[model samples]
Target: MQVRALARGVRMSPQKARLVVDAIRGRAAVEALAFLDTSPKAASEVVAKILRSALANAANNFSLNTDGMVVVTATADKGPTLPRRFRPRARGQAGVIEKKTTHITVVVSNDIEPTRRGYKRKPA
Candidate 1:
């Protein structure tokens, strides 16, 4: 059985969070935690917390062995953007500023093997 955890309205952009998520997907749970612990990206901190929650859910709720679990899927989705703020520009013009939010999900499973499809790079 796959166990998952979600964190909503995270104060980060989905694009930035995906950088960290893509790295940890398909890795062992313990290994993923280790990478997140040392990652410099701000998103890693949030992802780590959600990963821990998923492990806890598996162990406590589903009675699964977390030591053997692997990160099946880790993803970040764009969330509702906050109200737009405007800053005065050079000639009385307003500059729009958008504060983006994201929703992060991490799924771990001991029974299922993690598979990642390789992306092909186009010739320049």
Candidate 2:
């Protein structure tokens, strides 16, 4: 069984958030929460919130026990960027200032095995 939670248009850039998500991947749900709690990065808090949401979903909606759940998939994908702004630089040059955003998703599951890359199927 699996449950997913998404945090869209998060203020942080995808590249930065990816670091935190990668760390928590394939970890038990409780362990992931602990690591996120102690992490200093701004992204950790957002990821942790989403993780908790997933846990609640598993418990309330599906009536599943989340004690042994694992983070099956945790990803941070680039979201739409806001309008670009310009900052005046030396020599009267305008420097482009981009405000990036990201869409984060986390899937927690139990009793499932992740598939391998380049997977091939055999006839039953």
Q: Which candidate is the best by lDDT?
A: 1
| TM-score of every candidate | 0.87, 0.85
lDDT of each: 0.89, 0.87
RMSD of each: 6.3, 4.3
Which parts of model 2 have CA positions greater than 4 angstroms off? 89-93, 113-124
User: RMSD in Å for candidate 2, one decimal?
Assistant: 4.3
| Cα distance off (Å), candidate 1, residue 115 | 6.7
Worst 10 residues of 2 by lDDT: 113-122
Residue 15 lDDT, candidate 1, scale 0-100:
99
* lDDT tens per residue, model 1, 21-112: 99998888898899999999999999999999999999999888898788888999999999778998998899888899999999888865
Model 1 lDDT on a 0 to 1 scale: 0.89
TM-score of 2: 0.85
lDDT of 2 by residue, 1-124 (tens): 7799999999899999999998888777898899999999999999999999999999999999988778888999999888688999999999888899999999988765323321122233
At residue 117, candidate 1 shows an lDDT of: 44
